[model samples]
Target: MKVLGSGQYRFERVESWPNVPKYFEMGQPSDVAINSSGEIFVLSRGKHPVTIWTPEGDFIGSWGDGMFSATPHGIFIGKNDNVWIVDCGAHVAMEFAPHGELLRTLGNKNSASPTCEGRLVHAQPFNLPTNLAIAPNGDIFVADGYGGHKVHRFNSKGELLLSWGRQGREPGQFELVHNVWIDSRNRVLVCDDENDRVQLFDTEGKYLEEWTLGNPSGICIRDDIVYFAQLQPFEDKSNGRGSGSISLYNLDGVLLSSWDNTAGGNKDTLIGPHDLCVAENGDIYVCEVYGWRVSKFRKIQ
Candidate 1:
């Protein structure tokens, strides 16, 4: 069996996992999420925008054929198994029922907030939003990415509550806020991707601290552990293969293990890792945008 990582974090790769249908072409799996029933939901820019599968890699079905824009960026499953997807190209975020019924939509379709004029701009709703997270209190936090540098929080009713962050290297400012996640403690974690760090904030958008992860693009929190799927390191871009990796950290911001292989020989190696999710039983699924693949790593230790 092909293995990666070490210590309590070791994982064995599952070869050719999630048997993709021969009739379907899975363009680039932008993000992945697991529902309460242990079903895997992959959001891609493929023919079928959303594909569902069992944990055992059996294909179940698909959804959202013509409902989404050409670029679907992220997927997050809530406690009720409802799926939230962010469309960067359309500049909107949407919520859907497990069966593909559109529940709600946020932001104007194809309308981006004013951000291209300058780096330091605080915009409204979304400007190419990338990902979202729902707090236990029912507040929705969105990472307005690509064209903006802010995080917008909305109520459960889809009403805008507040927005924060600017474009800078400062503590509260963000460069590319790619993803957002709310831990069990209600701490708001935003992936400051371009700044190569994850910024922690209070529910009211107060700056707490930050952790330096390499171009952290994706974030997932299960129990007390935080998982990050990072993009290629800035220093190793000349490697040709592209060096991307996943990092695990404790709730208190302590690094546990980071696994990667720039040489690209190992099956567990990640390239252009844009997003990740942990299964109910601790299995890991990582999506690589540039590599055009999603790798499943079964927990070994």
Candidate 2:
């Protein structure tokens, strides 16, 4: 198997992982989240909307066939192993029980929030809530990305409590607010994707600070470190053929370790890594958009 990264962040790519069911056709896998049992939950826009796999990448089961939209987006696993998903096409955020039942939904489905054509994104609900993050107290924070340049906060009961963000190059603004993560400090860390930065904020929508991370698409917080996937390097941002990589940083935003499978190297390349999950054993799972594959990177530290 080909290897990627070095030092403490080293990982060996398994040649074949995640075998889908028979007659399955996937254009591209969207995102992934690991449950408390270490089982991987993958979100897709394909025939199988959600699939479960063992830690070794063995296919276990599948669900949510006709229940999702044409374009499935981010997913997050919360307490009691409940699954939270966002459908960019349907323009709604939902929470589902682990048993594949829909527990709750936010925003009106199949409805599009208004936005100008020339804008990169706008500040409004239902425009395109890309992903979500849940606080320790069970509040939901969503990154209204793609067509909407805002973040929405909701109570556990699905009430829209607060929302902030706008399309701009300024601190509180966003170009493509891609993903959201609630760190151990209970702060909201947003991946301002197109702006090449990660903006930080208090739980109550107060601006704190921001860090320059090139074309970040997703963020994962395990232990006290923050792990984020960059869709492409800063210089390659506009090209669309991004050399994707994942980077680890301290909660203070200090760089620690990074694995670049892009660049000129082809060993276990991670192209357009949209979302990632870290297992309790440190194994890293990455889902790519154009690559149409979910690759596993076993930790060797």
Candidate 3:
């Protein structure tokens, strides 16, 4: 799966977890989250279950076998150590205990309509939820991506507070609201991915401002820095050998350092890097779609 690009970036491939089930081998790795214990959780597309691995690349465990029908999009590890898995296939969000226990699942498991008050009624009828963010008050925010293009907020008990956003390319409008994260100020940052930018808003969905990132997919905010996994342009006919790059930006959307994927060569160069997570120790874990592997990068300086 090595791919070479005209740019200075090269992609390399890395073997993952030795041998796992055949079903886990392929699909796009959509979102990644690292827990307080340094465990990496990846929401992959090929299989309905989410895979968990140690920071050292050891297979820790896996769960959510048949819970999703389409694709598991976004994932996050809360401050309380609970794992939140967002299933775009099921059009719902689920919470699991640290040890893989099912704490609570949100959304109607068997609804067929797209307009449910508190949760998703029909799986494909509603907006596809991409990623999730937890507020300081324990409120959960789900970025409804493909279907309806809205951000749904819920209380700890799964009660709907409010939902906003519609389909458009304008500043307040969201063409593809891919991911969301809460900063230290409790402001919500939505990765308006398709718009080629990241838009900042308050918890109430008020439009603040946005900054470009070429083709951004996933984002994580740590301290005063925000890390973005920017995918290659889709229109390029390079036989999927496009080189993805990671960009570091500040809270005000100022560009810092940019890392070309050449660290792994062509195959290891990130292809369709959808999600990323930063460990407490400043290590970064990136999940890729075409490569089907998670790579870790550490800060040298």
Candidate 4:
């Protein structure tokens, strides 16, 4: 891991984690989440299973060796401290204990086949089910990103409640609904990555409002601030592997600040920043796909 930028935004390679195996190499780590104990769990696209590590970057353990079909994209640490892994290749969401015990799995292995249940259409032909967001009451929202271009909502027990949207560039439509997050007010925010915007909807899937972002990918909410991993399109012609940037917005959708690898003097930079998580102490952990690493930043007042 290379440190980039200056001031309070400098990136430092964590050189001393306790349990990391010296021989394990990871693929593009697309997303990341930290547990209450400060352990870091990374979801990668390289292999079938994901990797776990300490906040200090020590590899702890891994699970789900051969279960993923394509690649695992989005992941979240629930309020209950359970780990939810979204395997896009298999089009399903698997839940596990914080201790890596497999608890329950959702969705069909063959998602290409479509099935209907009453008024709810359960379509497995959905391409990539990327990221997920859990409500305060335990309702789960899955972004059917790559293939189907829809959002699937499920109850706490894995029962499908409803699904919405289709592939399109128009409002109320998503070309690639890559990620989802439930705000403090319970509003569902969907990162329409390909469409270059964020769409907000009610809990029942009704469109409320939308805002523009520069090729936004992973999204997370900490208190009143919403954090977005902005992956600028190729046309930007930025320097470094990726100009991996972070955009901060208020609850009412006000742009507050933009932080990047350029913040510090170092230029190792952030490339393909796919996901992000904020620690309780205001530290930001960004996972980059092409960079094959995770960068951490502390928020300074």
Candidate 5:
């Protein structure tokens, strides 16, 4: 079996671990998350949209048809098994039950902030909202997405408390705030895509620090390790196959290791790693945007 990563982070690739129902096709899997009971929840742009599966590759169920927007973006299974999803085309991040019951909605429906202005006008909760992160207290943090240059924080009851970030090449500013994740210390981590960096901040939206990395598209923090997926390759000569790579970091933001190969955009091992998450048992699941598939990597300690 093919393997990626080294030493403590080593993982054996598991090909075709998930078996969706017959004719269960999707355009591109946006994001994937595993719940406590080992069930996998996938966000896709398929006919059925949201689907669930058992650990043994059996199709358990699927739901959320004709409900989401034109495009499905991200999924994060959070506290109490609440399923959180983002619809960039519709510009909203909503909470839902496992059976596709709508619980709460964060952003305004079908509303968006003007993006081409090349700067942030103000804090508008709507406009291509991408991903979601839940704090220990149930407060939600949203990445206002490439369409809006800001990060939004809302109280548990869906009240907008604060919004921060702007458009600029300066340290505190952001070009495309793609995703957000709250770490063990409750520190907010934002994947600033177009800027090619990850900016750290306090829950109050205060800039803390930033780290230069390849076009980071998604972020997942588990235990003491931080895992981020690289955006798809576009440039003719990308540095170190800049796209389709997964890099690991420590809680202190120190570079630990990276999983990429060869050169000259040689990508057969890992392609278009849009979103990913490490399971409790150390397995890794990746959702892709260009490759139109999801990958599973088993930890081989």
Candidate 6:
């Protein structure tokens, strides 16, 4: 067993995690979220887009067959156990019940806002929206990252509330607005990927703070801690072959610990870690697009 961290935030890679059915195939697993009962929901760009499994890696079932575009970017399970899937290729976001019932959808399928051949001309609903986070009151915050640089807000019923962001390195602007999350204080945390920082804002989109965390591709909050899955590193962002790592911090942006997956050699290496979710017990599930698998890191101290 390969260990991947130290101090209070150590983890051991589960070499045999997520035992899939023999005939099943996973095509670029991108994101993961754990429901109320601790069931892990993985969103992938594959024949079966949504796959459910126990925390112990036992396969439960699957859903969303033929219901998504070729690229599904993110998966988020709200506090109420509603599943949200951001279809990047389709330029839409969908919400489903815990039992796989289609609840509602945001944006038009295959229809993105006006863009100049994949470049953002203006801020709008979605031009390849990446991820979403639900506030305690059910407000939806989406990161319209790819094909556009913007963050969109919506009410519980999926009505467009507002949108903010542009293409820049400034505070409110985003070079690549990737993942988003709502913390205990209801503050909005956005992963500005290319900017090499995570920007903080109020629910109304007011810029408050920013933290330098190399190429943060995914972020999640567990208790008083913030977990970020960094995609490679800032220096290696363009090359796409550097080892990404997981970093933990306090709510106030104080770095607690960081784990470099490559420190344990090739077997424990993580490539293109796009998303991650921390279990209640502190175990972490990471989704890698390039690695094409969801690997578990069991908390060991």
Candidate 2: regions farther than 4 A off = 1-3, 115-124, 233-242
For model 1, residues 1-301, the per-residue Cα lDDT tens digits are: 7556667877877878889878777778999999989999999997888999898888899999887788889999988899999999999999999999999899998998888533545567678889999999889999988777888899999999888888888999888989999999889999999898999999899999998877999999987899999887533446535568888999999888778744236633676888999987789998887678888989995
Per-residue C-alpha lDDT of model 4 across residues 62-102, encoded as one tens digit per residue? 87666666577878999778999888877778899877788
Residue 215 lDDT, candidate 4, scale 0-100: 80
lDDT of each: 0.86, 0.82, 0.72, 0.75, 0.80, 0.86
lDDT of 6 by residue, 255-295 (tens): 98887756677634676688999999999999977667898
- Model 1 segments beyond 4 Å from truth? 117-122, 233-240, 262-268
Candidate 6, overall lDDT? 0.86
Instruction: Report the lDDT tens digits of candidate 5 across residue range 223-281.
Output: 86899988867434544332478888998888776686332234556767888988888
TM-score of candidate 1 relative to the true fold: 0.94
For residues 180-270, could you state the per-residue lDDT of candidate 2 as single tens digits?
9998888999999989999999988889999998888978888887888887643343544446788889999988888776533673377
Q: Is candidate 4 or candidate 5 better by lDDT?
A: 5
Instruction: Judge candidate 1 at residue 8 and give its lDDT.
Output: 85
Ten residues in sequence with the least summed lDDT for candidate 3:
3-12
For each candidate in turn, give its C-alpha RMSD to the true structure in angstroms. Answer: 2.2, 3.1, 5.0, 4.2, 3.0, 2.6
Candidate topping TM-score: 1
Ranking by lDDT: 6, 1, 2, 5, 4, 3
The per-residue C-alpha lDDT of model 6 at residue 186 equals 78
Q: Which RMSD does model 4 reach against the true structure? A: 4.2
